[model samples]
Target: MFEAVLVANRGEIAVRIIRTLRALGVRSVLAASVPDRRSLAARLADEVVLLEGRTAADTYLDVEAVVAAAKATGCEAVHPGYGLLSERPDFAAACAGAGLTFVGPSPETLTLLGDKVAARDLAIANDVPVAPGAEGTTDAELAEAARDIGFPLMLKARGGGGGLGMRVVANPEDLAAAIEAARRQTAAAFGDDRLFVERYVENAHHVEVQVLADAHGNAVHLGERDCSVQRRHQKLVEETPSPVVDPSLRDQLTSAALRLMRAAGYENAGTVEFLVGEPEEGRRPFYFLEVNPRLQVEHPVTEAVTRLDLVALQLAVAAGQPLPFAQDDVRFEGHAIEFRLNAEDPWRDFLPAAGRLTALAAPGARLDTGYEAGDAVPSEYDSLVAKLVVHGPRRRETLPRAAGLLEAASLDGLRTNLPLHRAVVADPAFAAGEATVQWLERDLPALLD
Candidate 1:
């Protein structure tokens, strides 16, 4: 096991990683921005390094500063909780150059999977079905390619996530402007201006597969999650054992996900996302979306159903250990759901909300968070303040538990997406197991009205 690990991110994920590291007897080192001095993770970790800035660029994303801190603190490795430098191939390569272990996939795998277009081609080669559109993210020949792919398309940023650099073009007149906007956002967010055009599907469902691999050339899928309930391309609610997915579809998704991971020589925890279409020719179909190269924000739901500690698995894999269990040894016995409690007002177009979190008490099966009452909710980062995860033998048993959890929830000082989550749990369409990508976009948008 690594003797010491540095957490290179902020908010709930950092805290979550520290907890697991502490249990494994690994010293946890936290790096905080000027305003993050009082963050929960900083307080909870064994040691804290105060960086000299408020902006992420000034601190967390500053590679030299982070590596210097790691050296100064004598941390042996870095565990990028989820975002920030999690998928940055350069950072991983730098860590290797510095003789510091990066607790994730190799740099080659990150470079291979981090590029969306290239990954799509890799997917097709591995027999994974992909949406018809876009040559890839680095397709510098976009206008020519866009002209070929046709309008009513999707303009996506090469280095984008959480839907930052994505735009839908319904007409030829909108393509150029949409592409420019996506390029700008992608550049600002990812430092890469690569863009691509792809065929856009209307009203699709978002499903994801969680896969884990080890150094022994073995990988296994932990089943599927339906994260179709989203706002602005960001997922709001995630559930395991999608009610609408049949056993066959689940197997196909699982098989393809494992293939992609093995082909990329991926290790540890990663998510393979897909877009499932609504029944068009009387048969519902799914297409590859993208792969998140880190632990997902909703991984607890998977843990609840599978009874596995993914963070621990990551640690084991990073240390070059084989998986303790085989593919068939994994079991999925129940349905699980997780709701992201963000400090955002859903009715106001889901704008980011920030302020002191005066009070917070999660009400689901289990609550995971990095903030408590009196913690400041900053506007700079992701608004997710807490996660409410619940589990049961089936969806029917789980639905009521979800409703009660929401009703019992209480948060103050910061506007949250709680009410929106409440509405979704009570929504008849959602309750009847008929949620699709179009469900939120077209069917009354079950958010807080």
Candidate 2:
């Protein structure tokens, strides 16, 4: 393993990476922005390279700055945790040009998978199921494609994730406006205004497969995660060994994921997302959504069940080490759930809230956080404060424990969505694993009431 590596992001994910680096006996160098100079990640890192900016655009997203930090710090690789520039092909290329390894897929793979249209085409070519979609670069093309895709289709940006630059058009009359709006947003977000249309599946379960590949052409899937409970297409809760996915469906999903990754010559960790529609005539339909070409925010849930340190694997793969185990060697032990504790109030339209955490405590659960009792949550960047991961032998036994852990824990100073999580755990629908992608938004009032 490399002696030192640079952590190219912030928040709890940065802390998460540093912990794994320490365990693997690697020195961690953090490229921190001005606001995170005194943060938890900065404190835990073996060294800190100040990015000298406050906002994300000026700091974490600065490709040149991050790459320079790694060079100046004498680091061999850079680990971009989740968001920011984690999946940017340009970022990976810059690292490569600087003679530093990026702890993810290659730039060519990133470029191929980053574009939604390209990824969809790859899935189709690899015999993986994909939703009916068409790529369009102009308004006329999109409008024409929308007709073929039928009404109630989704207009999505060709690049980026986290629900940005996406729209649902229910009628032809609104297609023009939605196209203009999505293009503008996509241009601003991803610097690419290319758009596509896909048939939207209503009340679908958002399931994803976690696949790991090495440079030696070895690949294996840890399992599947159900992230159906979402708000505005953003996942709020995730669990491994989806309550609805049986062994047969599991095999199909994992096999499809491995096939696509191998076809694309992918390496390191990536997630293949799918939309599973309700069963009809003894058959359930699943369509490929997109591939997240980085370590996800909900990766802890997979680790909880698989007993694998994904960060270590990422580093080892980047260092040109072959995978130590094959598909048959991997094992799943139990059911695991992860709740994203965001600094947002679920009651007031889920608006982001920022303040000092005056009191914080979680007695007997795996809470991966970046703040302590006296830390302040800044208004900039993502509102996620921490991730609460809990594992149990089965889903039946996990729900009550998760609910009790939330009820017993204390987090103060800012409004949080703990109340909503508590409600979901206790709600019969969620406990029974019947919640869909739209369930959270459609039933928000009932959940928070």
Candidate 3:
């Protein structure tokens, strides 16, 4: 394990990392914006370095400031909890150049997987299947490049995630406008306007495999996550052992993820996403989506089912330790689901809600949160306040348990998506396995009314 480590982001994830660092006998250093200096993560760290900015863009996302804090604190490693700069290849490289472990994959690996277009090429090279879409970048050349990959394509930012900078153009006439909008949004969000084109998949169920690679070149997938409950590509709920994936499809997901990780020489934990279409007869087909190179917000659900401490593994792997067990040693039991408790209102178009968390508690489940009752949720970052993870012996048991957990939720001082979650958990369609990307928007209006 590292002697000392600096966490590169803020909020609950920072606290989560800090607890692990302390348990491993590592000194923890926290970087924070001025106002966040009084937050829980800062209080938990052995040392807190306050950046002279108020917003995440000027502080947590500032690579220079983060590295400077590490250098100042004599920290030997940096862990990007999640979000913000976790997936940035440049941040990883910067840490390496500064002689500190990045505690994640190599910058090369990040770049290869972060770009949607390049990742597709890698999947193909490793014999992994992807959606049938345009093989090249430059959505601006849509008209000239129509022969190979035709219409009903998706304009996607190569570096995009979190449901930003993506547009589906169903017709040729809307292609140019979609490309421009995607490019503009991509430039605004990630500062990378590079975009790609892929065939638009209809009514596809989103599935992902969580794979862990060690420095010793051993890679194995933990299991699969069914993230089909989404809104505009943003996952709202996630669970393991997908209802649609059978044993054969499970093998396909595991094998493909391992193959790609081996091909890229990847290390640490990562997620390989796939677009699974509704089953046709007895055959089911899946298309590859982009990979997330760091820990996911919904990792708790995986941990609940796998009985693995992913953080411990991450630290050990980054320190050059071999995995303690092989693929056979891993076991999966029960089902786990995660509900992201975001400070957003379901009424009036899911608008962001920011205020003091006067009273906060989630019932009937394991609550992983970065804030407390007294904290003020800022508008500068993601609205997620906590992750409520529930587990049971099977999906049937898990479903109602999730509903019970939401009923117990109480974020007294602030508005949250708890009501929306309650609606989802109680809906007959959701309970009967009819939840989809469009279900929320379609049903929310009437439910809210």
Candidate 4:
């Protein structure tokens, strides 16, 4: 391993990476913004480099500043712990150009999978199923493609993820206006107005597979995650051993994900997401959704079940080491669930809540967080404060455990979705594993009442 590495992101993920670096006996240099100067990650890191900006766009998103810090620190590698610039191909390329190892996939693989349209096409070429979609650079072309794709289609940005720059249109009358709106949003969010249309699956389950690849041409998938629970196209909770997926379906999903990664020559840890349609005659068909080219926020769930340290694996892979085990050597234990505890109010349309954490208490479950009581949550960054991960010998046992943990925890000074999580855990639909992508938005209000 390298003597030292720079963490090019902040918040809980930065702290998460720092712990792994410490365990590996590597020095960690954390990049911090003005507001995060005294943040938890900064305190945990061996050294801190202020990025000299206030907003995320000027600090965490600034590639040149990050690279300069890495070089100045005499670091041999940089670990971008999700979000911010983790998925940017240019950032990965720049790190390589600066003689620093980027602890992720190659820039070529990132470029290939970062574009939503290109990823879909590659999936099709690999014989993997994909939702019917058309890519276009202009309004006229998108209009023509919309006619072919039919009504109730999704407009998506090609350059970014995280449910941004996406919209649904139910009819042709709203197509042009939707396209224009998506264009403006896409340009503003990603600096790329290129858009595409895909047939929407109204009743779908979001499932994804975690894959790890090494530079020695070896790849293996850990397992699948059921991420169907969502609000506003963003994941709220994720679990392993999907209640609906059988051994056969799991095999298919894992195989498809591996095929795609192998085709792209992908290395390091990544996630391949899929949208599974409602079962038809006891058969559920799944289509490729997208690829997250970095460690997922929900990775702890996979770790709890698989008993593997994903961050450690990432570091080893970036250091040019082969995987210590093979596909057959991997074994999964019991069920695990991860709840994203964000500084948001569930009752107020999930509005972002920011303030000093005056009082805090952690649940009995495994907790990964960046802040403790007395830490201030700034408004400019993501509102996610912690990830609550729990595991049980069986899936049924985890529900009550998670509910109990949420009930016992205390959080003050800022609104959170803890109540919402409690309601979800107690709901009959969620207990039965029947919650779909739309279940949270469509059925949550009635359940809360």
lDDT of every model, 2 decimals: 0.85, 0.92, 0.84, 0.92
lDDT of 3 by residue, 1-449 (tens): 78999998888899889988898899999998987888888889999999998888899889999999999999999999788889999999999999999989999999888878888899998899887766345654655554357777777777868878778777888877877887788889988887777777776778899989998878888899988777677778888878778899999888998888888889999989888876779778888888889998878888999899888899889989988889999999999988888888776566888888998887668888889899988887778888888999998998888888788778777678778778877888777666655666667676676
Off by over 4 Å in 2: none
How many pairs of residues collide in each model? 5, 0, 2, 0
lDDT tens readout by residue for model 1, 288-313:
88889889999999999999989989
Clashes of 4: 0
Worst 10 residues of 1 by lDDT: 134-143
Worst 10 residues of 2 by lDDT: 276-285
Candidate 1 vs candidate 4: the lDDT winner is 4
Residue pairs with clashing backbones, model 1: 117-136, 133-199, 134-197, 134-198, 204-437
- Cα RMSD for candidates in order: 2.0, 0.9, 1.6, 1.1
Best by TM-score: 2
Model 1 residue 37 lDDT score: 83
On residues 64-141, what C-alpha lDDT tens digit does candidate 4 reach at each position?
999999999999999999999999999999999999999999999999999988899889889889988898878999
**lDDT at 65 for candidate 2?**
94
Candidate 1 ranges beyond 4 A from true positions: 136-144, 147-151, 280-283, 443-447
Clashing pairs in 2: none
Worst 10 residues of 4 by lDDT: 359-368
Write the residue-wise lDDT of candidate 2 on 149-242 in tens digits: 8989998988888898889899999999988888888888878888899998987999999999999989999999999999888999999989
lDDT accuracy of residue 9 in candidate 3: 83
